[model samples]
Target: MNSSDSLKLVVKQQNLEDISHYIYAIVYPIVFLLGIVGNLLSSLLFSVTKLNRTSCGVYFLLLAVFDTIALIGGLHHCLNIGYRVAIPNATYCRARVFLVYVSMDMTSWMIVAISVDRYLKVKYPITARIYATQKLAMIVSSIIMIIFIVKNVHLATVFIGDFSSNAADNCDANPLYPKYVAFFHNVWPWIDLTTYALFPFLIVTICNAFIIHDQYKRRVKLRKRNLDRSLITLLLVSSISLILCNLPITILAGVYTHISTSTNTND
Candidate 1:
């Protein structure tokens, strides 16, 4: 084709890609709405009801709260990006990014807390009494929230816009600080993967291992087969669900980073 015709062809291709992205964006709001409603109900059930005030119940309540934030902050952003809302201003963009990171960090640490709490209660019941109070858990969660917020403030400065010739979507990174922007945008998510995903997975693994070991010992010593079987099954089911819900998101984040980098390099 002639030069003008070739240019028109490329522009047409870009337009098609943009249209596809726009359609994919619609799925996010649906997911976000469902997440918000479900988590809100869970939070209310755990928090308001007198019968559900145990340590595990409290942990679930915190999980629901974090999930709600994730629905509002993270999923809602997906909706915005899908809709191509005029998110040109830095202030609002940063706020949205901040909320997303905070919610993610909160969710990760809350799961870790639950694993640790379960470990203590299962293996060291005496120490669990001192370390596993609702107050202490809240304190630890608060500290995690502060650290995540301060650490990810850089994300707030990172705007989603053109960075290279190949980029189809605007990414999040501070334009002024180009030196560290790439590192934060491309590398920092890996750090989050480790801290928020791998570490918690390890903790949960160890905690469950110990719980199983202790239960086996109890079953052998007491010979209470029926009761031991039921309890172990319940614990196993809960742990599996937590891992399942968390693993996909972590893997997806890593995959997305890789895909973005490849796309940028190709462009």
Candidate 2:
């Protein structure tokens, strides 16, 4: 394509990207507010009521905390897009990415924990009673949080800020950190895809599948089946939303990367 054609193409691509950003700028704040209210109420209920004494209730309580945090990340995203709040330094850039990823990661894996807790309760009641105590849940959650933070600690040093006076782009990873800069750039996107989206989806899907199977085998009463309806609905909605929302973006990103690589190779 000629220069004019190239400029048009660039404009078209920006339009596509900005369209989604625009929608998110408007929609994310609403979602953030609603999430804050819902999670706060849940936190209050789970804390004060008899629910706080149980293993599952503790998970819900923790989930509420993490969900609120993740929503804060969403709010910052809107502000960045709408107001052009530039990343001032490396620490700021790294901290922003770290905050969003840590909370979101914790939230996603905690859902899996909750899923497995329910599955074990249904599939092996005796074992669940023996093992799935409030103490165990607390221990597992602590372990998960520790492991997640350690695993992602590199993130704080990875992001580089825009020092330019008229910067237009968001923060990005520091290319100098990796010996093979090209390889690092190529693989960075997969981190969020796998950790935040893919693994969580798989964990939730597998646990719920077994839970449903176990429920089917037992002579479960109508009332008994409906007892955990609200929790189940929340799980279903969250899991499905995470998978559906992230999966398409992940696949498109992968495809785009592949095409770009092929074009570069040919050139």
Candidate 3:
């Protein structure tokens, strides 16, 4: 080959290598491991430990289940990409998309439910007793699941296909159907962030703030500093974890959207 021909071949080879590395080395394994480990630990801890059978434990358990499902859906996509699987046909694509969104929706709402439960328990103990029973928590979780399923089932009807005939292996929805892409990548992330990250953060912060304030007042009135410290520590840890897990996901979703849109525009 001539020099110019060799240079063109080199560029094409590098591009192919970049795509391969992204699918196999970066995206797939990170998402798979994190999802499995995080959700499994949450599930096992809640299932085996008697201490995890509280009203809050019910919420955590449900959250763990949804997280696992979401992670599975995510991992499936990652694996398909890494392996250059054809993804069979549109039926699998639709089902995978539906599962991904539904599980995500359920996870967000479960976090919301947990936040509300915590708020009630801290702010109105009597009301919390009536409203936040384990049975009640289960019922609420069931309703959330139903709502998410009904709302996102439309995804199962949307078909994806490989547009690149040159790469018989690549699989994705046709960009001609921009609506699905818009909904999946753009609209849904905002909704998820709002419900999962922003609202939950606010609820947890307010609830914990009040709890700490009340504890401080009680400690001052009763002169019991030692007793208050332990309670404060527990509440702080819970609040911090909730915030930490949620904030990155929300921020990353936005960043991902921006990057996706920019790339699409360039294309």
* lDDT on C-alpha atoms for all candidate structures: 0.67, 0.70, 0.67
**CA error at residue 249 for candidate 2, angstroms:** 7.0
Name the better of 1 and 3 by TM-score. Answer: 1
lDDT of 3 by residue, 210-233 (tens): 878776776788987655677778
Ranking by TM-score: 2, 1, 3
Model number with the top lDDT? 2
List pairs with backbone clashes in candidate 2.
Answer: none
Summed over model 2, clashes come to: 0
lDDT of 1 by residue, 85-159 (tens): 333445655676677777877787787778778878878888877767777766777787788888777666644
Query: Positional deviation of 18 in candidate 1, in angstroms?
Result: 9.1
Give the TM-scores of the predictions, in the order they appear: 0.74, 0.79, 0.67
Off by over 4 Å in 3: 1-38, 48-53, 80-88, 159-186, 224-244, 247-267
Candidate 3 lDDT score at position 44: 90
- Give the candidate number with the greatest TM-score: 2
